[model samples]
Target: MSLFTDRQLTALKRNGFVVLSDVVDDDTIEAARDAFWDGFPTDRDDYEGLTTEPERFENAWEYIEDPDPFREINDQLFPYAEALAGEGTLERPDGRIQVTPRFPTGEQTEGDERPPLHRATGHIDGYGPHFDEHYEVGYYTVMAAVYLDRVDPRGGGFTVWPGSHWYAGDYYADHHLESLVNDATLPAYEDGEWTRGEALAHQTDPLEIHGDAGTVVFWHQNLLHCGGINTSPYTRLSAIQRFVRPDAEEIKRDAYANPWKYWEGMDGVELPSAPSER
Candidate 1:
């Protein structure tokens, strides 16, 4: 059976993402959450201090040993992932899932007046400085975020700039794919900077995806996004995984030029052309 309806496919193409509500049941979500915290690092400092300095505990995957404590949840999501990316294109889920938990950074503290959305820093992954040297531009086909707990608005939700994929494709059409490989090169730094500007100028405002536990959000690889800051008292818990096409390198250039090239059901879907002014 198809995981998405006809309308969902169109939304994925136009908005660059689609959220599937309650893909995993509450029981499963609770089980996964329990297992995660059970294995969480005990050596860390006070939890409250860690909340303000999330850079210290942002990646929970590194501290956890078992790679697939959430295997049952992943099993439930596999069909949807396979449907979006063609058979044999997606990587098998083998490594540790990226456990991204945004603790309250005191954004709600008295006297600090920045809006929750303003705390988000949007950028495409795999190309920028501080990322592993092995990653490159267009390295992944789709990204999935599986929420294990309730996410309130501005409560460390996964924020995305809708339709930014098209703008990114436009920027990459003229630039060399190799430019994203080296951070020292001028193009590597400039590519994302320029694409973000074009996306914000052309597309709608960034959307903070908030929903109940078991919500699954899948997004295009080039979509500009970031993790929203947590202002509420709760810590946001989610697992992120990126799927890569088996032949990603072979068709890198073509895929970079055509934003919808690898998406299984996006063929013939009419979309707005890249802005002419850029």
Candidate 2:
């Protein structure tokens, strides 16, 4: 049987997103969650806003970049992405699958403030030179957050504007495409800048999903989304993966720029901008 049901496929096509509720099952998700805590012990008093802590990635390897374990999961879930591509239709040259984990509250390090949900992360993903210019088609990157633990609204959940991908995509293809041709780029700004209300024009009803650990939230690369604030004390850790569907090459050529992407040179030298980033 296909991984995705007819209803699920239709939702993806019509709305450009879907939530595979409990698709991974409890036991499987628990295993991954246990492994996460075994790596990072959240016993301290202050554990909010510590995404950059060395210990976060110190114990466990970053799964988004980890393919050894990812291949197994992808084999089980890839059919859905393929189905969304269209029945019997092969994925484009750049099609691939990936995962992402959002850490809203982190261990209090030496220098940091209580992290506010960054808003601009919603716009440009995958390979955009500026914030909103570079665009890719055929699903270059899809954001999927596999909830490993129970995520409450205060647990640093994903905040998204539903049906915003089509609007954002069309807006860029309309207004920004010309700017790209003219060498126009994102205005110089500090990190974590929020393009407030820019995404609201595309979506009237923004969605913030907070559910059980087994719920998986998926969104398009161009979709306007963010990880909202964490009012709870528990750490919100998810196994985030980025996916591709064989259609990555074409997207790479037109939309994505390999500015900081990692690559390997001929003599074992690593180039950050090769075919893929490690």
TM-scores for candidates 1 onward, in order: 0.80, 0.59
Q: Residue-wise lDDT of candidate 1 within 75-137, one digit each (tens)?
A: 777667888777666777764677887777655642345374744546666574334554455
Error of 2 at 255 (Å): 8.9
**CA deviation > 4 Å runs, candidate 1:** 42-58, 65-68, 109-116, 128-135, 178-204, 268-278
Best-performing candidate as measured by TM-score: 1
lDDT at residue 262 of model 2 (Cα atoms): 15
Kindly give the number of clashing pairs for every candidate: 0, 37
Candidate 1 TM-score to native: 0.80
